[model samples]
Target: MDVAGAPRRFTGQYYEQGRDIFTDVDQNTFKAVGEEPVSTFSIDVDTASYGFVRASLNRNVLPTPDAVRTEEMVNYFRYKYPAPASREQPFSTTVNVFPSPWTEGRKLVRVGIKGYELPSASLPRANLVFLIDTSGSMNAPNKLPLVKQSMLMLLGRLDADDHVAIVTYAGNAGTALPPTPVREKARIAAVIETLGAGGSTAGAEGIRQAYELAAQNLDPDGVNRVILATDGDFNVGITNSEELKGYVEREREKGVLLSVLGFGMGNYNDALMQTLAQNGNGNAAYIDTINEARKTLLDEATSTLFPIAKDVKIQVEFNPATVAEYRLIGYETRMLKREDFENDKVDAGDVGSGQAVTALYEIVPVGGPRAFGERRYGTRITEAARGNDTEYGFVKIRYKRLDSPTSRLLSTPIDRTKEVASFDSAPRDARFATAVASFAELLRGGRYTGSMTYDDVLKILGKTRGDDAFGYRSEFDQLVRRAKTASSMARLGS
Candidate 1:
């Protein structure tokens, strides 16, 4: 788990200088349903946390607690939710409650959202700018070289109508390839292959130039986006986070989206990359290997590129009659004020085509033991005061169209009747997601995981890993085993 040993696994030699940055945020705590019945937060589709954890474990290192986001880990795997029947709604919802595997008398409620799918033939033309970082820090094989390989995988899916451009930054930013049609595949491939790594990183300049090119050769009715591939080592210019965020916000108003593809590890600036991607109306993902590249760029190409809805936010109201205390599993970074949910100006996450986003809440029902503490004494509803025995809570979602400014609202009731008799009886996807979420909690100090151990996680994952076509679920199982071993060794060493 030592940092000094990491580079040896990937390369024989190691560099002593690298600046990786992450933000420290407080984790969510339990809430009394009687006092605060409503929980509001924005949707997050970023998968970087999962990839970063995988990279650290592969190097025999345990990821830092701050690096883990439980929600991202849960959403990394696809859930078998029903897709939306029409584009008018853009997404569908599936809600279910099951007995908690980790805690007795507690329940886990899952909210699943699946976006509408559009076939590749029906997908709009793409106007993409590949913003690459070719800095000295990216000299390793996993940095710039892997970026080239990842881009090539994406090229295989592009059509004749799609256009691509390449932009790189080091001491300065410049164009490596002008806007070219996808029909000129050989030319694009040649340009990508010739890219090399050197010089200091000027990430700000690269971002500006890439946005300019995307705007200049804009496809008015197509998917206009800039994909930034980097280790996120921005040393040269505009290092101030607020300044960079403002710049990205302005460009986002110009109808250009920015999706970040992170590479390498030692000097990765995850906080900065995440900020840019979130404010620039895009999703951020870390590409640690060629297989991850294929998963991001090819298998989930539609979800990665074609966004069906923007500013997606979710809010849940727990009935005091049915619940005592509840806590959201993760999404600490995406928490929003109650009023922000109704405010159209407040920016939030985007839902891409055919993507599934899941959220889990741990709830203690009325008369159940208080997991955190005694509930606040207030006006209590009697059985006669409760409206319906079947209704648990209400869920509301608000989102805007890709081109619209105003937002529309969707509301549904979460029924207690949908609760399964046991965790073993829950759908495979729900059980598998819970397993991943629990695993994350354990890695991040196990604050809310109760009695869940690494062995329990493995058992749950092994039993519920249903139909993993690409072996992502299987890979996750291996990761848990590796993490268990690393954690045990660390404890023994201490």
Candidate 2:
């Protein structure tokens, strides 16, 4: 119904982009400590990948490997890392090194950071622009309807002083509701109900319009953000993710940020959503069901809406004397040049209040089993200074205060002091995070996870699934079960 260079519009039933888009992820490879001693990357807290993977498994199908980002999947689960003492530091960093669960002769290092939570009474006012995509592609029950419910759930977390406006894009962008205080919540809900889906997607135009409106009422004293809720199918003008990425970057300079809430499938543009959110000084979440909506918007409101730190970067230096080789388990897309860590001009990920981030590295100790194969000429290994023998590596983290232009530094040594003798003896949260990383790797065809199967993941889940009051872990247990079933079905050609 549409030509090559022409935009798609609704016909009798629907004329939507009928395929999902995901950026293919090439798993990180092992690096010889002597060859590349420092590993640097940005912190990521987006949980969209896990929810999308679960949605796929719920339909009894394996998710496309490209859609499974191990970092996002692992970061989705909560971890009880120690919080910071005060807002001055904003967050606390903790480390634990334990034996690997899947592979022998390799150590798994856990780097954990927990942001300090702000009390409800101490939180600032909020100005939010609800940039809804009411394109024809959103006609499904899971798209526009779920988006309306999500906005209402998020609204419950806002203070009475907070203001909200609605902007929508279909054939073109328009302002659906002017900025209004939460005191007129009923009126806002009425406007949300009136939204209907049709026309070609005007995603890029909607972003421009939303940013303009957010600037007119930008709340410098509080949070100013444009929340884009869509299936991520940008079919009309300015559809390229790279172009949109630049616009969002420029818009972020004016103090109005962007966060994306992705909905639906078959037409999801995850790659574009990720580019916009990453450059917009914000995070992304996927809403598959009402429970997930409650979890992301209601339970995690404090963290999701208020950022305490921005442009967060992490650099870890592996000591050749102690560590022979190392590989970051996930974060394939977030890898940054080592020089980028110290450059304040380079934008990075942001951290929110009470949010926890976890990263794992698989390391081979000096003279241990090397994945890159043994060196030629049989060179002597114990040749480094004795003083540095105790430390495996040094971790340096740089983050900017939410309102500050300059960055601050936090560093610590990942030494034997942080190591536990046995994997079971490690901190429960660390062990649980390791399980998540292992499960994620296995889902992506287990290229690095040797011989590890679903049963192995289940065993790890059974032990490390700590006080799961929200039942998220229990839900994960069910998902793993479904994945096993799906895998069996696929193998049987059913």
Candidate 3:
């Protein structure tokens, strides 16, 4: 799956024009369970970071350290977790504990949330507003061309009853097409084909117009969403990320969500894309090739366009008597305060139909190899957990149904019942996730990976590729090799 178009040096960083913006985030550190036993973070289903990393590798460059988001990388590939019995529950949670392949005496705890899958016939009408960027910066072949084609791919997925609208911005914003039924597919495609790149970017205006269109055509029973396709270059009108996020949030409150599809390289603004998506109650994805467009728009059409659950938050509390230390593998930015889980006013990530979001934690059990020494003068371990000493942790999830503002809670315990005999005996999905997380960690300087190497990553990937019907996991194998090459090239300063 050559998701990146024609390669430059590695993939997404061919130009090196030095305008790509990614927020530098620090790696998570292990904490003694006795000190802070609770871990809280929102569920992230976005795959933008993985696509960006792959694009960089294809261009012969290893991704910038900040560009390697372990959570997005780990969540990019679909895992075969069991679905909820019904939409009433919305999602199912799966937990597994296995030995950490990277180091001895440590273990990996996997928490997976698989959203309920809905048959196409059961989905509500889709009210989609295509907010496209036609800025001069998007003139590159991979930018606007792919954006237009990506729109077509999504158009092909909509039902006749679905509605489509187009809003584009360069120096200014304008509607290329009004809200039209998918029954008029030819009209929609014709409008998309006519779109071209030129002039400065007025992305904020484009978003406003798109959201307005969606709002005006609000379907009480339909899923209304604004899909923004851009290089994330907002050169004109309300370029401030916070302001734009606030704007998106306002519209989200009115029932119109946003999803950003980033394209191109060098000058991409992944940070802004994330801000918009995160606040707009949507997800961000990068499309570097037609294959990626297909994966995001066609193959995962329902999941990409119709969210089944919103404001989903996960909290895990380690039993101090059973676990000594633990640290989350990714989602550094989505971390929430302990009280946010039950707060309906607090915003969190949304889960789409059939979307599976997985999170990993590296933990040291009591009497296991500890990452940090016991707090010499800290509070002593208590007997409060005496009855729960057999449990490694407790997992709690809070989520709201698509139509509700109130949240509900679901929980399960991570105990011996969830532990695998060894890494080799762990679920393939869990192993594969760990492999991806390890690879991402290596790319980000391997602060915690210790002796893990590309070879080790390949070893894990080789054994856990599963029956990758879509070849997604097989693609990861190639990416690992590409990363190795890119590392060598970087060392030589090629």
| lDDT scores in order | 0.87, 0.86, 0.88
lDDT of 3 by residue, 1-494 (tens): 11112231223322222567676566789988878999999989999999989888888788878888999999988888988999888879999999988778888999998999888779999899999999898999999999988999889888999999999999999999999999999999999999988998888889989999999999989899999999887777787666887899999999999999999987787878888899998999999989999999989888888888999999999998889999999898899999888899999999888999999999998888888876668656677787888799999999998878999999999989899878999988889999999999999889889799999999999999989988989989999999888886662122
Query: What clash count does candidate 2 reach?
Result: 0
Candidate 1, residues 121-183: lDDT per residue as tens digits? 789999999999998989999888999999999999888879999999999999999999999
lDDT of candidate 2 over 11-48, digit per residue (tens): 43222333666665578999998778899999998999
Q: Model 2, 249: alpha-carbon shift in Å?
A: 0.5
Candidate 1 off by > 4 Å = 1-18, 380-385, 489-494
Worst 10 residues of 2 by lDDT: 1-10
Better of 2 and 3 by lDDT: 3
For candidate 2, the TM-score is 0.94
Q: Higher-TM-score candidate among 1 and 3?
A: 3
lDDT of 2 at 408: 96
